[model samples]
Target: MRPVVFDGQFGWLHPAAGPHGVVLCYPFGYDALCTYRGMRRLAERLAARGIAVLRFDYPGTGDSAGDASEPGRWRAWIDSITKAVALLRQSTGVERVSLCGLRLGGTLAALAAQQLGDVDGLVLLSPVLSGKNYQRELRAGYRQWLSMPAAMDCTPEPDTDEFVEAYGFRLYREALENLRAVDLRRDAAAPARRVLMLDSLDAARVDALAAHYREQGIEVERRGFDEYSKFMMESLDSEIPRAAFESVENWLAAGSGELATAARDADTHLSADDPQGHAVEAGVTETPVWIDGGRMFGIYCMPHASLVTTGGTPAVLMVNTGAVSRIGNARLGVRFARRLARQGIASLRVDLGGLGDSQPSLDTVTLDALYAQDGANDAACAARWLAARGHPGVVLLGICAGAYVGLYAGSREPAVTGAVLVNLQKFTWRNICDETGKPTVRVAAIGSTRSYLRSMCEPRKWLRVVKGQTGGWPVARELAARCASRLRATLADRIERITGLELGASEERRPFAALDARGVPTRLLYGVLDDGVEELEKYFGVRGARLRRLRRVKVSFREHMDHAILSASAQENVMSYFEDFYRSQFGEQPGAVADEPADSRDAGRSGRRARAAQWLARQARAFRLSGEA
Candidate 1:
């Protein structure tokens, strides 16, 4: 599968020539993000089974070219499905096309099939039968997430009458209204010649939808989506329902012709040279690039023809946030990149080697490769890409694990002129690889664990802790020990700062010291009670006061902060801060790097990295099917 863009929507095209092609419609909002990797695996399977497939992000979502707040997004979403169907047919030259969708995507698929009037088949897996009911579920889910004791400190206030949220994604008022109006039972023609329905929670709605299809004399096959609960979840642990997928594949394959070997052979080594970007907005364009020799992937968003184009302004580099891909949690990365473009800055958001669209699974990647101190080689590739693209330098921004990667990569990469760290949990990670070469990943405490511990004062919380609610009691003990060392560490930090020298061993100050030598401006933002702040207080005084000793270091603690930028207000807060920060540092008239010719040396380095990456991309790598926890 290769990345593609059509009608300003980004998608992966699993190319093959067969009697049938598939357009896999993704559910809206966070569900789409959760199922991203699984959907990719499905597409790969379908393609291997001799069926071409195009799985896409709807407009205003994912890697597509728009913002979530735009009015009439629901209409645009339906239209996007229609567009995807056409693109798949045109690209694959298959007379028959099937629409397979999960959750809200399933709803969209049925609707789009009806619109097309000639779709061969429709598969709805745990689909939303009624828009109004789906909206109610969203509200319920939002309430449950907020009510969790662990989320109390970071809970967001949603307007009871106005807001509809799904984890980090929220629907706008008009869009919510549009969603409520979708009632599939109301005299809609059967969407396709044949239909497969995978029912999960709401049997009544599924039965109603099935009856509606039967009324129109459409052949319908209804089955239980037995694995739905585990399959539809946060990506890291979301199971890929292999049995459910097999049923759909068999159904689609029953009447489909074999894929033409000639066409399949022709697709080898897809010409991945930076595809031209469609206009994102009036002055900005986003081109999807397979950089690092095609071994890595990123969406390069650039600001065009800016009066703010001052020399020496660096582009921005956004890495994966935690285990999430290039889009970032709640699509903050895409939102922020476009926001920067409006401010006359360019940015590239990359999925590091083992995350996002990048091939290797997190299960296979060593802890040392992604989370540890010296594990930012992939980001180094992106920085080099930016430098060769004519950017004098780049500013690295990351949240969570990303922050750790950015801080280390920025300090080391010569082209990095600035670094932005948000809710950085730990300054270092412990890596222990086994003799078999597969790293035994010893992950540090994530925010959820810390949140659980913070509430351990309660008896119920202590019971849960004792029962090993935190994976194991050993982790809890380790956290307690770290907490206890704070006083000694803080005292040591004070002595070292006053003397302008290391007290004994190097601490968090090492990276900043290196960055300081290169005149890199570093900014650290944190929530008041965040786990990362404890380290800051221990090493640089409470709220990073002694951080001032490193002339280039600046820190901010915001009241409306969450470990993940989950809420609308939190996202607004971070974007506003970055805007002001950029203007203050780069001046209002500053410009990002441009597409000027790269020096031979810089080009050579970029070329080598790109070549290596591309070569790696050529090797056949298998994707997860059943999934692992």
Candidate 2:
């Protein structure tokens, strides 16, 4: 790796041998050094094709200097990236410069490209189009924390400040405010800049932004990828997929003539079917719409069926994995959203603050880095996104972790009218055993050591010693203690202090308290064969109907569906229940079509009763074989 520093922003710059020009690459969030490995491979591949690559980090992110918590740091970060691009041109003696960015970096690159006229081409991989949603996510997150009774006392629990997760940096308000001002739509049209947009399934907002560029007569090409590459969130043996690299390489190799033709052709298709195309109902075409959350990078779908003419549709905002992009979950969320949309009910599929093409994970960095509060944030963001697009009512339809986030967010945010928790895990004790089947308590201990040391090393160390020891075990028990004691010692207290923020049995029970206090409507659905079903039932019982207003049901599926809505059979069953629930609540629309009419009719006639009988049969079979309950 060729380590290079430009204006205090450090990164690796790979120069092509007798290069055609330089391409500056910016990665999402705290993924500075790690991002380069993929770009380096691309650089070499592109260099062989005659292009140099420059990859760097913004200040306060990655290995770059400055605290990410400072005000106006995002602008400064953009400025730093722009400067680095210039430096690459100067250092490489190249006249033309191409810019490439992933997620928020893509938005930043577009903004910078607008200001820097020297840019030749721009490659935006899932660019965030709004910043306001990103801010709402931050506020919603704070609300989630505050909503947890006595959770936000504002008293600093020692070493509970910093957290790092797969998403990115974990600064509370600092990153949030900075990200709230970025607007890619405003900067979409860069004069004389050739733009290439790479999208996965969740590219509605970005595609819309790209369409704006095309309308401005800017050269733009949009490419869709089939696979989900978690390069930004996790370190893989390979970073950028071969297909993505090949596509970009082909686009670059063709030169301006082919590029211009490609752009025009792509724009032609985009215009014909406006990337944000709405579902057709009753021979009327509705525009699929998105609500921008300013700099916060929150984007939500607003279906046309929810219009007043549709007699007020029942809506659901689908939530998914914190680490996975909204695009990756599109197969499930889109399927459900379309199904709901087809039923004369609306569904808003939202990209949580940091995930997807919304914004850098730094923008809404959570304390646990999991957006432990994102479910609430997502609910609020979805509502805001919907209200902005003129939808009056919305609910939550979440699966697995998405269900948890939706439930948490729905409880805190009033915008959520209702929530459907599918395959919920009320209380989970994951990582119980290591690969060798040994208890993982020791491993957890070692992981907590670093936190422990940080707390002890603080100025008021002696005064905080008791807090440190009590908190230390949360970390120590979470990691493998067999690792270096030094590593264990380093994380000990900090891990405890941070883990201390976690909702214990009592704290976890508070949502039920808030539900009782607020009287929110909730529906909990679980597969009986699924793990943790008993625990979830207990949770619902503990919270009780007063707070939760919960109606719980256990689906009698013979096989366990491992969370992702992966099985077609499982998906069909879940969708059927969702459609029925939505229809019952919102009433049927004039000309809404059912995706699975045969299944719907069959389900309506005898599905539930038949499933019940099957469950009984299984129970009888087990009893006869084992002679036990």
Backbone Cα, N, C clashes tallied per candidate: 5, 50
Per-residue error for 101 in candidate 1, Å, reads: 0.6
Tens-digit per-residue lDDT, 1-629, candidate 2:
23455565655555553434545555543343334445556665666665666676577554344445557675786688679877787877755777777766777787788888767788877655555554444345444533331121122222232321112234434444545555566654653367888877457776787788888877889888553355553322224567877888777666432221111111111121123332232322223233332222222333343443444654567665544434223145544554454445555565565544333323222223343564467557767666554555666777656666776776677666656677565432334444543345631213112233444566665555576644545455433432343233224423444674322245555654454456445555544334333344233221121112222222222232334444444566667766665554455542332222344234436777875764465446432221111
**lDDT of model 2 at residue 440?**
51
lDDT for model 1, on a 0 to 1 scale?
0.74
Local error of candidate 2 at residue 355 (angstroms): 0.3
- Worst ten in a row by lDDT for model 1: 620-629
TM-score per candidate: 0.83, 0.41
User: Which residue segments of model 1 deviate by more than 4 Å?
Assistant: 148-151, 259-274, 360-369, 372-375, 432-483, 497-508, 538-541, 544-548, 588-629
Worst 10 residues of 2 by lDDT: 260-269
Top of the candidates by lDDT: 1
